[model samples]
Target: MTTDSLILPIALPLLGALLATALPRIAPLLGVLTAALTAMSGLWLTGLVWVSGDLSIVLGGWGLPLGIGLSADGLSAALLAMSSLVGLGISVYALGYFSGSERGLHFWPLWLLLWTALNGVFLAADLFNLYVMLELLGLSAAALGALTGSRDAVSANLRYLLVGLLGSITYLLGVALIYTAYGTLDIGLLSERVEPSALVSTSLVLMTAGLALKAALFPLHFWLPPAHANAPAPVSAALSALVVKAAFYLILRLWTDLFATITDAGAAFILGALGAGAILWGSWRALRAERLKLLAAYSTVAQIGYLFLFFPLLQALPPGPARDDLFAACVLMAVTHGFAKAGFFLAAGLVQKKAGHDRIDELGGAAQSMPATTFSIALAGSALIGLPPSGSFIAKWVLMQSALETGQWWWLIVIALGTLLAAAYIFRVLSRAFGQEPTPQCFITDARAEIPALLLALASVALLGLAAGPIWSLLGFEGVQI
Candidate 1:
C-alpha cells in the first residue's frame, strides 16, 4: 500500500459525516456504507503495517513543522483495527435500535464524526494534531451521549462536555510548553529534542494529568459512570469501550514512547497505585449497582485500572523479551476489553428494550425471553471476569507472571481481589437470567441486533483467546511466545 492509503481511514468517514448531514433522508444507508469502507481501509492499513515495518506520510507534500503528519506502527495499527471492528458492530446495532426514529437521523452524522476523530487520533504524528483530534472526539462524544434527550442524559453529558474541555485545555498547555522548550509540535521531532529538564518534566506531568482525567483513572473517574449509564445503548458502547480507551492510549504513548527517557519508577508507581485503587473501588461499586447499564459502566472503570497496573511492571523491567511480553499483555487486555465491553453493552441494551427497564433485580423474565442476548451476556461476562480460554485470562496470567518475576508480588493480591470482584458483579447479573418464565421457541429474536452482539462477544473469547499469538506479531514481536 502507498503512503496515501493512510488517509482513507480518516477521510472516508469524514466525507460520510458531511454527506450524512446533508442528506438526512438517506443517512442510515450512507452511514453503514461508510462504516464498512472505513473498516476495510483500516484493516488494509493494518495489513500493510504488519508486512512492512511502519508507515508515515506528510499531507500536501509539506515537511515537518509546516505539514500535518500521519504515521502508523504496530500500536496504532492494532488500535485502528480494533476501532474499525467495534465501530462497525456499533453501527449495525444502531440500525435496528434507532429504526423509524428522528434520533437516527442525527445519530448517523455525529457517529461518523466520532469515527473520524477516533481514526485521526490513532494516525496523528504531531502533538497539536492530537489535541485537535481529541477536541473533536470529546465534542462528538458528549453530543452523542446526550442523544436520548432525557433529563439525566442531558445533565450527565453536560458535565462530560465540561470535563472534556478542561482536559483538552490542560493538555494543550503542555503542548504549548513543549513547543516553547523545543521548536516543533511533531512527536517524532519532540522525542529527539526532549531532554531531562524542569520544563520537560513539567510538560510530561501536565499532559499525563490531563490524560488521566480523560482516561478516568481512579479519583478522576467521577464523571464516567453517570454519563455512560445515561446514554443510548450504541453511544454507551462507544463511550465506554472506545472513547476512554483513546485517552489511555495517548497516556501509554506518552509514558512509553515520547517521554520514556525522563519517566522513572517513582512516577510509574504512583500510576499503579491509582490503578489499584480504581480496580478495588470501581469493582465494588459495580457489584452494588442496581441498574445493569450502571454495573457495566462501573466495570469499565475497573477494567481500565487493570491496564495501568502494567506500567509499574513495565518500568521495572529492562528492554527485553520480558518487558515485551508484559507490554503485549497490556495491549491484549485492552483489545479484549474493547470487544467484550461493546458486546456486553449491546446485549444489555437489548435486554433493557425488551424489559422496558434495566434494573438488575427485575430482569428475571426479561432476560430469559431472549436466549441469544442472554448468551451473549454470559460469554462477555466470562471474558470480563478473566475466565479460562478468554483474552483477559491470558493477559492477566502474563501480568501476574511478570509481577512475580519483577518481585512485585503484592500486585498479585490486587489482581486476585479484582478478579473476585469482577466475578461477583458478572455472576450477579447472570443469576437473574435464570427465572421461572417459559423458554423461548427460537434462539434469536432479531438477527440484525443480536448477531452483532454475539459475534463481538465471541471474538473476545474465541478470536482473541485462542489466536492471541497474532497480537504479538501485530506488535512486531514475531517470535515471542505468549
Candidate 2:
C-alpha cells in the first residue's frame, strides 16, 4: 500500500472525535471500532513497508522543501504500530473504564481526540507540521487530564497545561530558528541543509529542551506524576503510554534528521548528564511514593529518563562508526517502554478501582483474589525491570554494550541502578498483594477492563528477544548515520 493509503489511520479517529460531540450515545462503540480499525490498518501498513520498502505521502502534491509531507520509515512505523495497538487497548479499556465514571459524555470525545493527536504526531514529517500536531495533542491531553474533576485532577491538569505550553512555545521558537537559518522546515530538507552554526545550536537547544519538558524528562518533570496519577485509569494509561511519547518522538526525529550532522562531544555529555539525573531522581521518588498510581506515575518520569539516555548511547559511535544498532536500541527502548508503562498504569488503575484507593499499605492480598490482574502486573513489571528475555532487557543489553564500546561507562551504571529501582518499586507493590488479607473489593472493574492492560503487558513481554531480522530491518532510513 502507498503511504497515503494509511492516511485513514489518522483520519478515522479525528472523524470519530468530531462525530462524538454530537452522538455521545454512540461514542463508545464508535471509538472502540475506530481504534480497532486504526490498529489493524497500522499493522497492515507496517507489513506493507517491511515487504515493499518504506513509504512517504506528501500532503497534496508538495515535495519536501516546499509543502508539508508525511513519511514512514521502519522507526516511525514501529511507533505507529505501538500507538495503534495501545490506542485500541485504551479505547476498549475506556469502554468499561468509563462505566464507573459518571462523565462518559465528556470522556469519549476527548479520548478519541487524543487518539487522533497521537497518530498525527507519529505521521508528521515537517518540523512546523509537527508543532501544530503537538499543539493539538497538548490541548486535547490537557483537557483529558482535567476531565476527572477532582481537586488533584484539576490541580495537576493546570500544571500540565502550563508546562505543556512552555514546551510548545520553546519548540515553536526553535522551529522559527530553523526556518530562518535554512528556509526549510521539512525534516528531510533540513537534514540535507543543517550546519553547525549558532542558529543550529540554539535551535537544537530550544527543541531538545522543549521536548524534554514535554516528555517529562527529569528536572522538568514536576507536573507528570500528579497529572498522571490524578486522571482516570484509562486516561492515565493513555497519557503515560502515548502522550509523553509524542515529545520523545519529536526529539528522536530531530536528532536523526538535523542534529546528527552536528553530533559532537559536548552536546553528548550534556544530554547524557540529564538522562542520568532523570533516572536517579524519578526512581527515588517512585521508591518513596506511598500509593500505587503515584508510584507508577513517578516511574514514568524515570522511564522517560531512559529514553533521553539514548542520546549518550547513540553518541558513543566511534566518531565515524555505524550508529544503526545504537539508534535501533533507542527506538526499541521507547517502543518497549510505551507498552510496558501503559500496561503498568492500566494495572495500577485496576488496583485503585477495586481497592477504592491506591495506597500501598492498604493494598493487602488483593493480588491473590485478582490473580489475573496481578499476574498481568507482574509480567509487565518484569519488562519494566528489564528481566532477561524481555524486550526491555534486550534494550538494556544493547545500551550497556554500546556504552561499554564507547567507554562512556557511567550511563551503564545508571542503567543497572535504574533497573534495580524499577524492580524495587514493582516488588514493593506485588509483595504486599501476595497473601490473603481478604479486603472486600470496594468495586470490581470488569474483565474487559483487564484485557487491554493484559494484552499490552503481553505485548511488552513478547517484545523481548523479538526476532532480530524484523526489528533490524525496521531500522532502515535513507542517507542517515543511524
Candidate 3:
C-alpha cells in the first residue's frame, strides 16, 4: 500500500533468517511466522500494483544510478504473488516434513534465507543487485539441498554450488561489460541506452548462457535432476518450483525488455531449437526415470523448455495484440508450473515418507494408502500434461493458436509431442495406485501435510485455469481472444 512496504517482503524474511540462525531451538516457529508475514507482504504489494500500475522507490532516498531501487510491475508482481502462495504452501509442508528433527534446526534459517533471495530476485530493479541476490540464492539453495546430509545429496549440491558460481561469474562479467559501456546498472536506464553492437551482443550471450546453466536448459541441465532429487522434500519443492524460475525470470527480462532492439530472429531460433531439444530429451528421460522425484525433476526441465519455445514466436510476431497474448500466455505457463510443481513435489514427498522410498515401480502401497496425496499428484500431473481445466491447457491452446497464426507450425508438433510424453509419464506413475494394495478408510491421514499439497494443486487446476484473465489485465494486455 505504501512505498516503504516494498522492502518488507525482502526485509522480513532476512530478519527472520538472522533470528532463526541465532535461535535454533525455535527456528521452525520463527520460520513459519516469517513465511506467513512475507506472503502477506507479497500479496499486499501485488494488490497495490494491480490497483495502481507500476511502483518503484529508491531506497535511502538517494535516487537514481547511485542508490538501491526496488520496483514492481505486472510481470514481477505476478511472479511475486505466485512465489508467495507456493512458498507459503512449501513452508507449511515443511513444518510437518521436518517435525522434531535435527534437520529443522538448519532448514528453517537456510529456507528463510532462500525465500529472502527469491523475493529479492523477483523485485530487483538493477542487474548488479540481481547478481548479488542470485549469489545468495545459489548459496542458500545449495545448502538447503544438502540438508539431508546423505552422500548423494552432498555431492549433487556441491556440483550445484560450483555450477551456480560459474553462472554467477559469467553473469557478473556481462554486468561489468554493460556497466563499462553504459555507465549505469539500473535496468530502466540500460533499457533505453542499450544499442546494437558487438559488445552488447557478447554481453547478452554471456549473461544468457550463464542463466541457462542455472535454469538447466537441455545440455546445460545435467546438474539439475540430481540436485533437485537429492534434496529434502520441501527443499526439493523450492528448488524445482522456485529457484530455477528466478534464473529464467532474469533471462526473460533481459531478452524481452532490455535487449529487444539487438535480439533478432536468428538468436531467437537458436534458443528455440535448444528448447525443442530439452523438451524431447527431458521428457524422454522422465519417461524412463526410475525414481518419483527424479521424474518430477526432469519434468521441470521439459516444462522450462516450453517457456523458451515462446521466444521465436515472440520474435517473429510484431508488437500487437497477438504478441501481447503470446507474452501473457508464457507468463501464465510459468506461474501455473510454479504452483503445480510445488504441489507435486510436496505430495511426492508425502508418498515417499509413507512408502519409505520413492521408486516409481514400488509405490503401490503408499499411493493407495494416501488418497489425498495421490489425488494431489493427479491434479498436478494434469497441469503438467496440459490437460483441460488446468492453466497449462489454456496457455498451450493460445500457444498453438499463435504458432498457426504466425505460420510457424513446427512448434505445434513439439508441443503436442511433449504433451503426449508428459501424459505417458504422469499416467505411468498414476497407474501404480490401482494395484492389489487396499485403499485406506479416510482420504487424508495428515491434515498438516496433505492440505497444503491439495490446495496448491487445486489452485493450478481450478483457480488459475478458470480465472486466468486477470493475468492479462495484470500484464496490461487488452485481453487474449482465446
Q: Can you write out model 3's per-residue Cα lDDT over 1-482, one digit (the tens) per residue?
A: 38788899899999999999999999999999999999999999999999988989899989788999999999999999999999999999999999999999999999999999999999999999999999999999999999999999999999999999999899999999999899999999999999999999999999999999999998899999999999999999999999999999999999999999999999998888889899988899999998999999999999999999989999999999999999999999999999999999999999889888888877775555898999999999999999999999989998998888888889988987898799989988888765655334365899999999999997896578656889999999886665
The sequence of per-residue lDDT tens digits that candidate 2 reaches over residues 115-151 is 8778788877788878888888888888898897889
lDDT of model number 2: 0.82
**How far off is residue 240 in model 1, in Å?**
0.6
- lDDT tens per residue, model 1, 1-482: 37888999999999999999999999999999999999999999999999987999999988788999999999999899999999999999999999999999999999999999999999999999999999999999999999999999999999999999999899999999999899799888777778899999999999999888899999899999999999999999999999998999999999999998999999999999999999999999999998999999999999999999999999999999999999999998999999999999999999999889898877776555899998999899999999999999999999999998899988888998899899989987877777654344355899999999999997896578646887887889875453
Which RMSD values do the candidates have, in order?
9.5, 10.0, 9.5
Worst 10 residues of 3 by lDDT: 434-443
Task: Order candidates by lDDT, high to low.
Answer: 1, 3, 2
Q: Give the lowest summed-lDDT range of ten residues in model 1.
A: 434-443
Q: After aligning candidate 3 to the native by TM-score, how far in Å is the CA of 218 from where it should be?
A: 0.8
Evaluated at residue 70, the lDDT of candidate 3 is: 94
The better candidate by TM-score, 1 or 2, is 1
Cα TM-score per model: 0.90, 0.88, 0.90
